[model samples]
Target chain A: MIKNFIVLLFLFGLGMIFSALLLGYTPDSELNLTGRYYAEHTAQDLGAANIVTAIIVTYRGLDTLGEVTVLFLTAAIVGMLLSTGAGKGKSLQRKLSQSGELLTTGSHLLVPLILLLGAYVFINGHLTPGGGFQGGAIIASAILLILLTDPLYRFSHQLISIVESISGLIFLALGVLGIFFAGGFLDNRILPVGELGSLFSAGAIPIIYSLVGLKVGAEFSSMLVNFSETEDS
Target chain B: MVTIAMLTGFILILMGLYGALTNHNILRMIVSFSVANTGVNIVLVAVGYIHGRTAPILNEAVPAAEAAARIIDPVPQALVLTAIVIGLGITTLMLAYAYKLYEMKGSLDISKFSELKW
Candidate 1:
């Protein structure tokens, strides 16, 4: 009872401290500087209504590219860790086959639609609230659905690895092109900005977002596969 | 209205904290972590909300200048989306590790799985 009382007192004190910190906080003016300018200029200059996408893929495209690399590295590490033990592969396959047909058919019906939606989100990211990350997650969800419905459905390791590597290379090539032809790395002005709110506008933002979407989708799918397969083993 | 959302978010966070603190199972702890993360995400989205505004987008109906004047910030939405994905990835990884540990030790209780201590 004494110990419990002490713990409760400690928690109360911690809560009080956190509340004070929250109450004392003020929004930094400096943080608003870029956000304000970005909001003002994104539509006029980049022709993208989604200021976040403009910031991510145009103003800070390099950072987004780097972020993709971080995801890639994480997938690699997780895959390596999960694949270390693999004795019951055949049994796992059998268990997967027996899971039922409803899941399989439902996932089949949904996967294509999810993929299409993901593509749409990334494609229209410059014009809408959605972007590469949102689109990529949606795409990943499709893959996860497949993994869940069809346990026997094994992703071709070679194909996923090849896709991931090729996307990474393409991402690098685009960045290098930006450095060579544009203002700096990932500058979207390499091609004309076209017109505001047009699909063809934002130069390389859409292309880069599409690439990121693919990479993230593939990586996340592979990670899910790795985790599920490990469980079966 | 915003204050209500903030209060709800805080309540969820507190509940998650209580669960995490009290739970004996590793899986429960992880689930509490997820709840806390979601609560934080809700707070973030709520903070970006403005009255009588829609998402930041330019359509033929709304001119670019007028659209900018009325749109709520999209940065937090994008950031939160990224955060959600990252959180999902981390959660999956944690669950995977937990499963592996369970397989090896035949237990999910946190108190019994302290083998790495020096």
Candidate 2:
């Protein structure tokens, strides 16, 4: 107990030191507004009401593409690690029978709603706080729920891989198109800039977000399935 | 005030760090890491907070310049959203690995599992 207390104290001290050095420190000038300028100009240029959306889908879209690729690669790695041939030992099979009926039924009922919500979040990401990553995680959670409730419900690996690959290809193609037409990679002005705050506005952001949402959802669901199957094998 | 919130967030992070460092169980460590990550995200969002502000949007009621003037920083919110996604991905991966390790070793204890060591 004494040792634990000492360790806690030491950690507390370290945390305080770090927080003091980092958190409490303010910027050198309050008038410095690089992000503000970018926010204002990019909003008009990209026809997006949300500057962050403009940044994610237009300015730093290459980074977002890379992020989606990372998720895809992660899913693939997890899949490879967990996959085993058929006729594995029975010791790996999950005991789904032990779980309650209510849990299973509730998850079954909630899956569609969760999926809809995820799609909505991605679709309206340009106008809201949520985006592709958030939506994808929500969709992935639905798959996770199904996995927990019904262990025998196997994922169609071929379909998932195809979805992932197709979305990734489309995303890359869109980026290339932006370069060819808009004079830069992932530029949003390729499409006509409709009125601000309109659904048709924010050229390429909503579309990119949708693609990202699909890719992330499929990848994460594949990861979950892969992980669960490894245990079953 | 934002400062107080920041302080509280830091304290939570400290607690999470302690839990992660001292815990013997792999699940506990992962949960603690998540807690710490959440605390950091909270601090980031808090840093973007304005004393008196509204969401960043322009409409018939609110003019564009007025909206921009009163709006709280959207950059941090965007950043936090991305962080949350990445965090979810990493946490899921960790949980998956933990599950795999449990299957192979039949134990959740970290100290006993040392198959890959140089």
Candidate 3:
């Protein structure tokens, strides 16, 4: 009872602080300096229709790269921590109950469509609301669906690693190329910023985003595979 | 609108914190933490909302020239996106650690693990 009281007291204090913040807050009628600058320059400077995408993929590209690196580290750590048991490379002998017919059939029909939508989302990151991270997550959901349908199914670790490595390498290489040809590292001006809304517009934004999507998707799939493959250790 | 979203986010944060503090099970704690993480992300996106602006996307509806005046802040949206992804990574890490703990102790109770305590 005393512990509950203490917790409630703490929460009450926190709530007070939050309410204070809420009471003092007012929605801005005009864009602030940074927001104004991004809004004004994102299109003319980067040729990306989505200002958020431009900011993430180009203006703050290095930060996004760091974020991806953090995700890579997380995946690597999870794999290392989980894979160090007696169930490393052994074939699956444990029997899993069959998933329902509805799920099996639904996954078969949806997996291809999901994969296509993921690809389309990342490819159109510069022109749409979706981007590399979201698309990559969608792709991972497809892998998850397959795993759910067939728990014993195995994905090629080699293929996933290769896709991850190549895309990461190409993403870094393009950033370096920006230094040589454009204003700075990861600048999207290496290729001509084509027609603003065209498929090939936004210079290298679409390519970089696509690579990011592939790398992220591969990383997430690898993690899911590792998690599913864990045996009763 | 912004006030409402911000209020909801705050309430969620408080509720999550209460759950996390009171929960004894490791899985419940993890779930509470995730709820708090979502609340934080919501608050961030709310902070960027302008009174009468569209999203920070330039299109036929929102021409580039008037973007500065028309769009809400994009920085917070981008930051929230990063936060959500990082939050997922952290949640996955926590689950993996929890699994390892379960394997070691065969229990999911928070009070059972005392090696690092004290």
Which candidate number maximizes lDDT? 3
Residue A168 lDDT (model 1): 73
Q: Write the per-residue lDDT of candidate 1 for residues B9-108, one digit (tens) a residue.
A: 6667766776777777989989998998887888777666666676666677657776545667667766676677777767877787788778788888
- Please give, as one word, the docking class of candidate 3: high
Model 2's CAPRI class is: acceptable
Give lDDT: candidate 1, residue A18. Answer: 51
DockQ of each: 0.38, 0.44, 0.89
Q: Per-prediction TM-score of chain B?
A: 0.90, 0.90, 0.97
| lDDT per residue as tens, model 1, A41-87 | 87777777677788778786766776777777778878877777666
- The C-alpha stretches of model 3 lying farther than 4 A from their native spots are A89-91, A231-233
Ranking by DockQ: 3, 2, 1
Interface RMSDs of the predictions, in order, are: 3.8, 3.0, 0.7
lDDT string, candidate 3, A1-56, tens digits: 99999999999999999999999998889889999999888888889999999999
Runs in model 1 lying further than 4 Å from the true structure = A1-11, A17-31, A93-101, B116-118
Among the numbered candidates, top TM-score falls to: 3
lDDT for residue A13 in candidate 2, whole number 0-100: 88
Error of 2 at A181 (Å): 0.6
- CA lDDT of A46 in candidate 1? 73
